[model samples]
Target chain A: DAGITQSPRYKITETGRQVTLMCHQTWSHSYMFWYRQDLGHGLRLIYYSAAADITDKGEVPDGYVVSRSKTENFPLTLESATRSQTSVYFCASRVGGSSYEQYFGPGTRLTVT
Target chain B: AQSVAQPEDQVNVAEGNPLTVKCTYSVSGNPYLFWYVQYPNRGLQFLLKYITGDNLVKGSYGFEAEFNKSQTSFHLKKPSALVSDSALYFCAVRDAGNAGNMLTFGGGTRLMVKP
Candidate 1:
């Protein structure tokens, strides 16, 4: 109930198509983050939002776009999905920043063909 | 740059024995270190953290970690391992002076406990 959630827990999209993954948190956390998890690379940040309308790029933000229209939502969009873009996406929320602990969502598994 | 290293890809421990998963970090200033656990097909869960104050921090599921600032290491340890404790453990650190809520995570270590 009062936890982070991601929509479409599993997704399969074709290459070059636009795909969006939704993330919502019930805690009204100020900071929301999107990360992609791969086999070799544990988890790489895609984008993060400090607050509503305040977004920042992370380590691997290319080809991805994110926006926080409200405190409870932070959605990630892939302009043109590729095979490399397919990975498990995780959404996390923190009341503050990294100085505080983060709570994560179940995660969305995406496969691009 | 800030980074975290989890040297071992996998760790094997027998039930009732002590267990340890090594982690080393590099940060600009005083580091905020954390350990998270993840079960198969699930999101990462908070385990323990060493922000300030104490060096020996105990966490959920009877797990504890010792922070060695001198060695830049914060290793997770459990006095007695359990079969249920097996999972993927990750060590992470935030970049110094930047409160971006961005954490650099290690590649993760798979812990397997044998009964």
Candidate 2:
């Protein structure tokens, strides 16, 4: 009921297809982020939003798109999924007061074949 | 650019023994450091943080970290290792003045505590 929640915990998509991973937070945190986790890479941010209409790219933003129309939701879209995009994706949020301590969602494991 | 480094890819310790996982950082201003633990199939869990004040900050699961400004390191330590302590640990740093709380994380160190 509270905290962050990620939808479609497991997803399988064909290469070139579009897929979107959803993230929702109940805390109403001002800062929300999306990251992809892979072996050896740990976690790298893909995109982050400071507010509903303000968003920016992170370390790995290529081929991915993100939008935050409301504070509670931040969605990550893969316009044309590739095999390299097959990895676990996580959503996180932190209040503007202390953006340092982020709360992470369980994650969405996406597979592109 | 600010970044963090965890020297060891993995650390093995016998149960009941003290354990440590090393981390180092580079930043332009005062650093806000943090440690997070992640189990398989789970998101990273917040461990401890060193913002200001004291160098030694204690966290959940009997874990603590010592910040050494001179050494530019923040190493995680536990008094006695437990088998269940096995997990992936990450060290992160943020430039307190301008980083806006977005943490730059270390690659991560996996801990294996054996009985």
User: Which residues of candidate 2, in runs, are more than 4 Å off?
Assistant: B99-101
lDDT of 1 by residue, B1-115 (tens): 7999999999999999999999999998888889999999999999988888889999999999999989999999999999999999999997667655678999999999999
State the lDDT at B22 in candidate 1: 100
Stretches > 4 Å off in candidate 1: A97-99
lDDT (Cα, tens digit) per residue for candidate 1, span A9-59: 999999999999999999878899999999999999999988999999999
* lDDT by residue (tens digit), candidate 2, A26-107: 9988999998888888789899999999999888999999999999999999999999999999999988875478889999
DockQ of each: 0.86, 0.73
Tens-place lDDT digits, model 2, residues B3-91: 99999999999999999999999998999999999998888889989999899999999999999999999999999999999999999
In model 1, the fraction of reference contacts reproduced equals: 0.74
Docking class of 2: medium
What TM-scores do the predictions have?
0.97, 0.97
Residue A35, model 2: Cα distance from true site in angstroms: 0.8
Q: Give the range where candidate 2 chain B is weakest over 10 consecutive residues by summed lDDT.
A: B96-105
Docking class of 1: high
